[model samples]
Structures are given as C-alpha cells and as structure tokens.
Target: MTRSTTDEAAVPPLPSPKERRRLREAKSLSEKEVAAAVGVTRATVRSWETGRASPRGRKRALYAKLIAPEPAVKPPAVKPSVVKPPAVTPEAGAAAVPEAAAAAVPEAPDLPVAPPVPEAPPAAPPADPPPAPAPAPNSDTRSGAEAPDERRVSPAEAFDELYARTAPGLVRQTYLLTGRRALARESVERAFELAWQRWPEVAVDRDPAGWVRAAAYEYAMSPWHRLRRTHRQPDAPPTEPGKRALFDALLDLPPAYRRTLLLYDGVGLDLPETAAETEASTPAAAGRLMTARAAVAERLPELADAAPAEQSALLHDRIGGLARAEHVPVPRPARAVRTGSENKARLWTRAAVAGVALLIAVTGLTLHTAPTHYEQPISPPERVGGVPPRGGPQKLTAQDLKLQKSLSEQLAHGPERLVPQLE
Candidate 1:
C-alpha cells in the first residue's frame, strides 16, 4: 500500500515529554536532564510528551528542534504490520503493567517492542516551581554569537582620531583667547601632547577636550610663562590706525581678565564653562567680562552707539584682526636654563669656591699668628707650708672658707648619733 502523506509533513509537531525523553535517551540523556538543559522542570517535559499539555512560544520551537528526527536518505520503504489485536476495555488496558513502567515509559527509546502499561496511573503532579529570573542585558547565550563589528577600538586609537578631528578648532579657540598665533599653537599643541600621554585616563573622563583646554590655559598663565614674558617684550606689530585703539585696550587688561572675556565672547563658551576653563569663579569671570565689555565700550564708542549686531561684528573684527597680526613668539627658554641642572651646578660651584676661599683665609691667618711655644712661662710658685718654690694649691675665696669651716665643724663633732630607740 502507498504510504499515507499528510499536512504534518509541512508543519512539524512539537515533541511530547515522552518523545523528548526517548530522543534524550537515544542521545544518552534522561527526561530530567533534558528538562534542565531547556530550563524547564521534568514534570513540564512529561506533560508535553503525554499529550496532556503542549509546549508554546520559544520553548515550543526549541522542543520541536530538539526531538525532530533527521531526514532519511533514500531508503526502501517498509510495509505496515499485518498482525491485529482484540480491543481491550480501558480498565483492562490500565491493568496491563505496573505503575513504575508507565512512569518510565517517557524515558524509553523508540525500540520495536513497546513497554507494558501500568494498572494504576502515575501519582499527582509535582508542584510548579517559581519562574526563572530574566536574563541581564547583553548576556550571550550558547547559540547566540556576538557580532564582529561591535568590538571596541583601543583608547589610544580613539584619542588620536579625536585629536585629528578637533585640533584645528582647538587652535582657533586658543588663538581667539591669546590673540597671538604662536602662543595659540604652542598652547594647543602642549595640551594635546599631555592628553596623548594620559589618553587612557582622559578617554574615560566625561569631557576630555575640556580637560585639555583647562590645562592649556593654566600652563599659558603659569608664573614661569609670566617670568619669561617679563624678560622679553611682546613683538606684536603695531595695530593699524583703524584697529589700534581696540588692540591697546585689550592689551591693557590683565591676562586673566582677558582670557575670561575672549573665551566667553570670542570663543563662544558659556560663562560656567569659561570660568572652569580659566579656573576662575563664575562671578569673577562674569565681572571680568563686564569690565572687558566696558573697556571695549570706551575704546570703540561706535559699539555703544551701534546696533547689537554691529557691536558683535565690530568686536569680532577687532579680536580676529589681533589674532591675525604677527606677534613675537615667546622663545622657548634656552635649553640649558630650562633644564635647570646646569644653573644648579654653577650655583653649587660658586658656593664651593667661596667656601674654599673662606677656609684658606682662616687657615692663613691662623698660621701667620701661630705661637712659637705652647707652654706658658712658669712664674715662681707661692710658698705653701713654707716649702720652697713648689706649685701651690688653688686659693680659696671667702665663700669657700665659710663652706670649709661648716664641713670641718660638723666632722669634728662626729656624726650626731641617732637618738637611742625612739620613745
């Protein structure tokens, strides 16, 4: 007879607990073991196999895949069995085998012979355990693989990329603040160099660029830079007659106030960020900006009289023109002086030479005044006990005589005896 074909061929059935147990056993696993692998209880697996319940959702899909038989290669089809058996009553069927065999039926392999059924049904169902907790975010599973593209790049590489992208803007910002192209370049380059050194730490910081800018501003305004500036005058060429008034006005302000104004108004940083960058309190930074505004107002009387847009344009032009002007580069301090070790060595050599000169002078004076003989002249000794010319004992003072008398009197009296037996 031709084998019956059905819609089941197109849509596979989910595995029953018994089927799962059989498959698991064929693959060397028990019902409870398969249940544990699928993160469900043995009872749930059992219910599914017995046709008492059905597996659902992702779990059902997993169950179907686990127990589905491999497709057969082109093998000869087998004929159905010809033997027929008498229909038994339900009670008779129940009494065919022991209860244990029924329970163990789920674990049986798909062998030719069927196991006998039990007289009694299996025991009451086991209690349902609590549901498992949800998996944490981004947890990988056994079958689920991570995508290659999601891997992170190294911090150094990332910092290098960011530096390349932002360096020009950062240089422009520095130029606006200092109005000196060389100083701007030096400040921006130094800041980036320091950032590159600590890229790992800086990469993790919330605002790495801001941190760099702050560091650059601090380095530019340091006492060392101030001292260097004091020795060498700025070489910025005289501003043209049109911009001369504005240039002088800006130069007149202290560097701290100038930085605050430039960062806020010129570079377009908000007050708080400008304050933080300049290491100034917000109020102080605001006051500096106000003072800068007033100074600009005095010099560019047109700004006070012009519309707001005109005033903005005028200020920008003045600051931008100053930045474009050729200013004398602050020469990198001479390498020997910058290193400091050479100066320190020279100082020590001078001190050593002075110490040696002092020592020699003292020694020479001592040698020049050296005594011919160390022994003092021996004067004739005073007579003692009428002995002739012997060295006499030291003379006693009046106070010594009194002390001697008291000691002599006390000794002469013999130590006062303690009173015999206290009464």
Candidate 2:
C-alpha cells in the first residue's frame, strides 16, 4: 500500500453533518474522496454527514466552504452627485470633467470604504505519505538481511592476509638457513615489519610476500647469526635418523652453499629467484646449488644420484614438517595496521612536501654560497708551443700530485705496474 506525507498547511473546518452530506451528494463525490480531501477517516466523515456529529476546528472551515451559503457582494456606494453652482448657457457647467479636477476632489471621509475580500487558503490536499522512514541503515553486516556474499579486499586486509599465509613458511625457510627457531622468527618478524612499513607499495606487488621472504632469508643469514648460537627446534623432534643426518649436514655447509640450497630446495624457489635472494647471478646460484647438493650427497648417498626436482621435494617435506611443528608467532604491524590508510597517504604527501622544500633550500643555499667573482679560471701558469705545461713545481694539492705520480708510473711501466699483486 502507498504511504502518505504530512501537510504543514492547517486543514480547514468541516460543516455540520446535514450540510456536509448535502454538499457531497450535490457534487456526486464518494464519501472516501470527501474524507481524503478533509483529511479524516470515512467513519468520521459519515458521522458528520449523517447528523450524528459536527466537524470542528480546521475541518469546519473546509466543510463550510463546500456547504455554507456565500456572503452577498455589496455594490459600491455612489457619492452624492457633485452639483456645481448652476453655471449654464455659455458657462463651464456643460464641460466634461477634467482628469486633474476629478483627482483633486477629496471624497467624503464619512463614506466607509469596503475592505477587499480575502482569498480562500489553498487546500491542504493530502500528501502521499512519506516512504516509511528509510530503515535505519543496516550497520552490522551480519545482523541484518544484507549479508554480503563477498567484498573487495582492502589493501591492508589483503596485505595482512598474505602475511598470515606466507610468514610461517618464510620463517621455516629462514630456520633452515639459520638453524635456530629464535633467529628465524626474529628475521621473519623484521621482514614482515618492513613489509608493513611499505605495505602500500607491497600490496600492489605481484608477489607481495616475495620481498619479505627474500629479506627474511637475508636477515637470517647475517654474520651476527654466526656469533649467536644455533639450535634445532625442540618442538620439532628429529625422528628419522636419515633426516637428522641431513639436517646436521645442512648445518655443516658454508653459509653461501647452505643459503642457495635452502632457497632452491627448501623454499622451492626457482634459480632466478634464489639468485636474486642471495644477490648472485643465475649461473652463480645454480653453481652454488650444485656445490651444496654435492656436499649433501657426500653425507647422504641417497641424494647423490637423485634428480634436482626429487631432491627439492624431499627437502621441502623435511623443512616444512619442522616449520609447522613449531609455532612461530608472526609479528603484528606497529603503525600500519593500527592507523587508517588515509593517514599513511598523508604521511607520504608530507614527506614529499618536506623533500621538495629541502631540495629548494639546498638549491638556494648552493646558489647563494657560490663564488660570484674570480680572478680567472685555473690554468697552467706557463705554456710551451700553445700547449699547457704538465711538469712543473705547480700550485696543486697533494692528491693531484699523487695522481700525477701514478699516471707517470703507469705511462713508463705500462698498466702492469699498477697491478701490484701480479708483480
């Protein structure tokens, strides 16, 4: 059913029941129509029209207009004929009235002027009711019928999800490298924190977690880790004797060889990715992987002839099992996850503005500080045959003199003289 709106205009008064029924019958209007127009229920209109009740207040005014007799319009009273002293014959009595003289006459004050009839108020037609106040917005998505089937992932949401999914695996790979649960956790946590710091950039990246995992890998392999003692995870009890031997052998290799093996095998990254993580060329990474595999094979004969893919699969299982056994809590974001993304945008904008200001300041200072006047540009004091002199007790700094001496030695003894180790 359609709704209705309230009218601000006051509703007119209704007539007595007998008069109302008479007017409604005369107009052949339905009771419902008259009731709607009068802004009342059909029952009320029927009661008023059937001599059972009388309309009151604003409704009375409205009903009166329909049924009450109109007041007679009075003719304007004529002014007593203005008789001039009988000016006749050739006198001015015959002349029609002049415009100015008619205006000049002051009408008798005693003749009361009729007031203008006031117009009827525009009818307060019933308004179509306002759409039932639009429902209080459904704030709780779960509370109302508007349960979202899906939603677009916000950048922060997407980044947090990626972190949750990848961090444990990343920490495990780090564990394989450092062989310490604490260090691996520390490294992965640091990496995730950096990712959070630059999440805006990381969120749009094809591999958001790749940079973090790579960074964590680097962090876990720091020289400081050498000083810090390493230990097998207590939670991840080494069961198989062969796996224990493999883990021990992995620890025995140099960091470069071990890191390559973990990146390629344990992390299941390809050659290029492994290379990038280790800061090596693809060939270098492959060579290092080969070296690490050979070294592992020396300890474990089963892997000596195993295919690269098979070996990687085996290492992944062993490492993944260990990583999953221990619960390394992922680091929570400090500032990024807490504040709104808009704030991060504002920070970057502020930094850009500051950098621009600094650049302008530096440029101004450089221009202000530059020498305005100089006697002449530096040149050789003497020239021979229009060529600048090279050899002299010249006004030059010690560094310039040293460069000159080195050049002389190179020219006399060839480039070989500069190669001290060869000599």
Candidate 3:
C-alpha cells in the first residue's frame, strides 16, 4: 500500500477530459487502442473521455501515462572535481623541504627555525571541462532526432508529399460523403487541384490536411450535385447487405449531421474539432452526432443492441471498411495536378482578358453606331391639302370624234385652213 501510494504521488494528474482526448489524437491513438493499453473496455475509455466517469487505482495511473507520458527528466550537469592539497604536519613539511633549503634557514633559539619549501610545481591546468552534454534532444523533436532536410524542401516537393500522403484517405472519406464513387474521386482530385493552386496559403496553414479535407468535403456535399444529370440517379448500393445498409443510412442523414458523424466517429477528431470543421456549436455538433447515431441504429437492428460507445466504434469500422471496399481510383500525381492547375489558371486568365477586350469592342461599337441626338421620326405619308378627286376619263362622244376628224381633214386641205384654225 505504501509503494502504491508513492507510485500514485509520482504520477501526474491526468489532464481534463478534452485534453485527454486531444493528447490521444495527437499521438494518433484510437480509443480502442488506448482501452487495450489501459486494460479496460472501450466503453470505459469513452466514459473517461466524456467525463462521465473516471479511472481509479492502477487504471488511472496507466491511462495517465498512456495519454500524457511524463516528460523525461534531464540528467544532472557533470561538475568539475576540485583537487584539494593534502594538509601536511610540521614534520612532513620539513621532510617535503630539501635538506639544503632547511640548512640555509637561520636558526632561532626561541622560535623553531622556519623551513622553506621549494615552490610547488605549477598546478596542472585544470582538466579541460568535460565536454558539455550534447543538448538533450527536444521532447518535441520527431523520433528524438535532429530536424530532417524537410526544412529545405521546395514548395512543389512538399505539396507532392502532402498529396501522396493524404489523397488516398481523402478519397475514401469523400466516398463516405457522397455514395457515388465517381463523384468522390472527382471531388478529391478537384480539392487537390485547388490546394495546388493555393499552395502558398496551404503550405503555411497549421493543418494543411484539414484544409484539403474541408475543400474535399465541401465539394462532396454540395447540393448543386443534385442538378447534374449523372448524379441524379443514385449509384448501385454496395453488394454486401451490411455495407449497403450502412451506406444507405449515411445517405439518409442530413449533410451536416453526416459530416459531424464522419469527422468525429469515423475520422477520430475531437468534439471541438468536429464542431469547428462542421461550423456548428459544440452542443449542436454533439446533438447531431447523437441524432445521426440513433438514426443509424434504428435502421440497423444489429447496432441497436450495442451500447452507444460500441455502436460508434462499429460505425467507424464499417464506414472505413465500406470506403476501402470500393475501388477508389488512385489520385493523379502531384506534378500532374500542379500542371493542370497552372494550365487552368492560364486558360482562365486568357479567357478573362479576351472577355474584357470583347466587352470594350462592343462598347466602342455601340458608341459609334448610336445616334448622337434624338431625331424626330419621319411621319407616314398623309394628304395635307383638301382636293376634289378627279373623275375617271369619260369616253369622248362619237360626234366630237367626227368633228375632230373634219377639222383634221380641213387642216390637211390647205395652209389657209391651218391659219384660220390657228386664229
């Protein structure tokens, strides 16, 4: 009992519930793994994390050590050893002195003759101070090794590394987001392309993977996908009944609830992180998580029998398995993605310039063709003066025609007839 108490005292108190979860995640450990390490059921671990329950005795100490390992104690500095000269009695001092030096000393009757000691050999230079202990590797340093050449990596190389590391898992996550494999692959590709385009911003971000993940999730969950002819029909459900049921249940959920579930349960993110990623309040995220889980359980009778914590673990495994079962096409290479992004940017820029030029030309043409001043429109033709209509020509009477003929004959008869006619 005394030893146990001493051990407990030596162990530091565990961090808050949230912090415990964070430390576990920071180490990339899942609750099941932690539970196994702590020798407890997974549910106990969950309860401990939620603060509904606490571990005691050996379990508490073990759990504390697992989640938050105590920092290594630094070794004490090596102090230089000081060599003190041995004290000598009077006789020893006289012996240490040479006979000649002792003889040269003046004899005094009252005070014993003082013996002169030869000057001590110059003290050996203090041994070189022990080389300072190599600076203890920082606890934060990866694998307790010096920082790697990654610091000198070029932007493209870094981007490629990020892509290769995350693209597969992202593709799977996207598959969960959208049931359609094709859309999932497309969304992941598009997300990486955007990341490549904005590499400068992404490279400096605290969580570059999260940045890409958010982009991918946003793309996968877009309501606009409903408008697409290809996406209008659902893809064939998974062949296995269990997978099919889980996939269908996930699809039935609201996008936000589904996302929260996936991030927290499936991706192993903390509640605050899930809420942040989903852009919901903590309570709201928790509520959604509960609702989503309950819905899944209701649909699948098998899960209904299990406790909530176990249910969550099952869901996580199922979702992961389902995602993996689908043959997600491998993501395009990072170099290819970067090249495509650059090409797209160039194309868009050219298109924008051309559009501006076209707009300018159109504006100029409109200016040239537009009337400078409003002109009164010409009026349609109308009769302004009142005039009587002329009657159609009437046929000349027969007698008038004969008189005309006789006049023409008399005129033909003589020039005198023509002169009379003129008068």
Name the best candidate (by lDDT).
3
Query: How high is the lDDT of residue 417 in model 1?
Result: 83
Backbone clashes under 3 angstroms, per model = 4, 17, 0
Please give, for residues 227-339, the per-residue lDDT of candidate 2 as tens digits: 64453332353567776777778888998989888778777777756665565555788999988888888887877778977877766776667556545655555344335
Best by TM-score: 3
Error of 3 at 225 (Å): 1.8
- Considering TM-score, which of the candidate structures 1 and 3 is the better prediction for this target? 3
TM-score of 2: 0.41
Mind giving the per-residue lDDT tens digits that candidate 1 earns over 1-423? 333444443345654333344454456555666687677998887667544678776677666776767676887766654332234445554346556544544443544434344444543444566698987657774366666657768765676666666666666556544555566667766776667656666776556766677667766555565456632344353558656676667767788887777777666677756655564445678898878877778887777787645665677666766555634343232232223434555688999999999999999999999987888889988756855675879899999999999997775665768877876
TM-score between candidate 3 and the true structure:
0.57
| lDDT of candidate 3 at residue 215, scale 0 to 100 | 88
Which segments of candidate 1 are over 4 A away from where they belong?
A: 1-147, 175-181, 229-231, 306-314, 317-423
How big is the positional error of residue 232 in model 2, measured in Å on the Cα after superposition? 13
Candidate order by lDDT, highest to lowest?
3, 2, 1
Scored by lDDT, model 3 comes in at 0.80
Lowest-scoring 10 consecutive residues by lDDT in candidate 2? Answer: 113-122
